[model samples]
Target: MTGSPEAQTSQTAEKLPLPIRLIDGLSGLSAALAAAGLVLLALNVFLDVLGRTFLHRAIPGTIDMTINWWMPMLALLAFGYTEKMQDHIKVTVLLDSLPIGLRRAIEGVFSLLAAVLLMFLAYYTWVDAARSAKIGETTSSSPPVMIWPFKFVAVAGVIVLSLQLLATAWRNFSGRLPREIDFDVDEAAL
Candidate 1:
């Protein structure tokens, strides 16, 4: 059998269509940002714990900072990466049992549906981000943190996911997907 979808995708990564390529590039950047956010989140939590436990004081604004800033960054930054990787949860039992042509037709229809929904989501999110920026929305913290940047980040992430979904739909329509190629375990070796 072939390797997982992720492996198959990576093998032909460079040959992906333009929309998929753009999504992959943006996903790579978002993955890096998410990694940094993870590191910062860990440090922040560690420091807060240390201060509360030994110093008899909690780090000021730690919760506020995490909830207002780091949480959004960590949560939304990996959207495109996960989509590009095809690592998201999917129910494939029925699809796998179906005949190839039928399965592909179903997948294509579902992909288009997902793309349309994601497009609406991205549009609404961007509108909200714009509104937040216009009003200078802030969290209800001691020194209330401006929330528009985080909202914009969310918009960016959703847009990337929407683009990726559209790419997937196009791939299905064009019959360029479901490439179950086995690149490992050479027959010659046998």
Candidate 2:
């Protein structure tokens, strides 16, 4: 019995193995972390407001915790996952007008640039984390929690984003990515 072309393609895709699947899974985790961080931020704000309005006492260190810690984590963690899903905002007026080959070439160049930027970010953040860890850096707020963890999170997120950018570049090089005007659109629209 012979398989259909679609089935053959599906099997070939499946044969690409578990690491890409794991990377995709990690992207999902990053997204979940970002969502959780947002929820936490909102909750902190709500609690602070309640405390200030009704209880006549603001939540101590809430601003420090949410702003200094949660927001950075949220933004960093969301970066790679959002890019992986092609959910990042784009002004595609120019890109959309370009020929497929030219558009892909442009995308490849941009992906390489993004990967380099992310690598630099990861390197600097790792150094910052190391310095903070060595010096035992702590927030100047009431609770005075250690700040190195947040820096480490930033480094991890940047590394993940860098990997995703490299993956995208590889996909583009191999002609795997669809020749679509907008990445968010369905493949049929390409």
Scanning candidate 1 in windows of ten residues, the lowest lDDT window is: 177-186
Task: Kindly report which residue stretches of model 1 are placed more than 4 angstroms away from their true locations once superposed.
Answer: 1-11, 174-190
Pairs that collide in candidate 1 are none
Candidate 2 lDDT for residue 137: 87
Clash statistics: count for each candidate: 0, 0
lDDT of 1 by residue, 1-190 (tens): 2798687667777677666777668888987898888899899999999999999988877887788778888878887677665667877757765666666678778877887898898899999999999999988777677788888888877777777676666666666653541324456967
| Candidate 1 lDDT | 0.76
TM-score of 2: 0.78
lDDT of each: 0.76, 0.76
